[model samples]
Target: MSVDPVEQWSGVLDRFEADIALAVSGGEPVPWNPPVEAEAGPLPEELADRARRILDAQLESMAMLGKVRNDALAHLDALSAVPDSQSSAGPLFLDVQG
Candidate 1:
């Protein structure tokens, strides 16, 4: 079976993102980083445009992730509201008078 081009591209981008994040977080050294050079070019205008697009895409992805998390949490809360016999035990009583 052949891999989808979009899936392949996404894997590459995910690796690039992880490497950048690691360098930024100090898990990897910044000085010898290769991504910096990969992004650098003599054409500043084109690079700037590409950077803006990448940032916009990343922001959208984050927003979608947040929405998914919120939806999942709301579902969990709704389920939690329904009391289960295993979870509904009587209040604790201490035998301090014994």
Candidate 2:
């Protein structure tokens, strides 16, 4: 059975939201690869503008997530560079006497 365009777009948006949520929560992005079918004519003006806006927002969000991940990795790298003070202490044992 052929699916309606509205239904298809709705499903795609739903998946897009879910994937975005996963990415926001520090999980691997769940790819939403819907089948691409070519349309016979250009999209309506309003639909085209809405799609453009959504795409722009999605791209912006992805870029922000990438920055956050990169920043965290950089911070970890900086921390790893610091020498552990315990390593310099050379294994001391303490005993308590009553």
Q: Which numbered prediction scores highest in lDDT against the true structure?
A: 2
Candidate 1 local distance difference test against the native: 0.57
Top model number, TM-score: 2
Using Cα atoms with residue i matched to residue i, what is each candidate's TM-score against the true structure?
A: 0.45, 0.61
Model 1 — TM-score against the truth? 0.45
Off by over 4 Å in 2: 36-46, 89-98
Per-residue lDDT tens digits for candidate 1, residues 62-88, read: 676678779999999999888775666
Worst 10-residue stretch by lDDT in candidate 1? 34-43
List CA RMSD, all candidates.
Answer: 12.5, 5.7
Q: What's the distance in Å from true for residue 3, model 1?
A: 32
Question: How well does candidate 2 match the true structure in TM-score terms?
Answer: 0.61
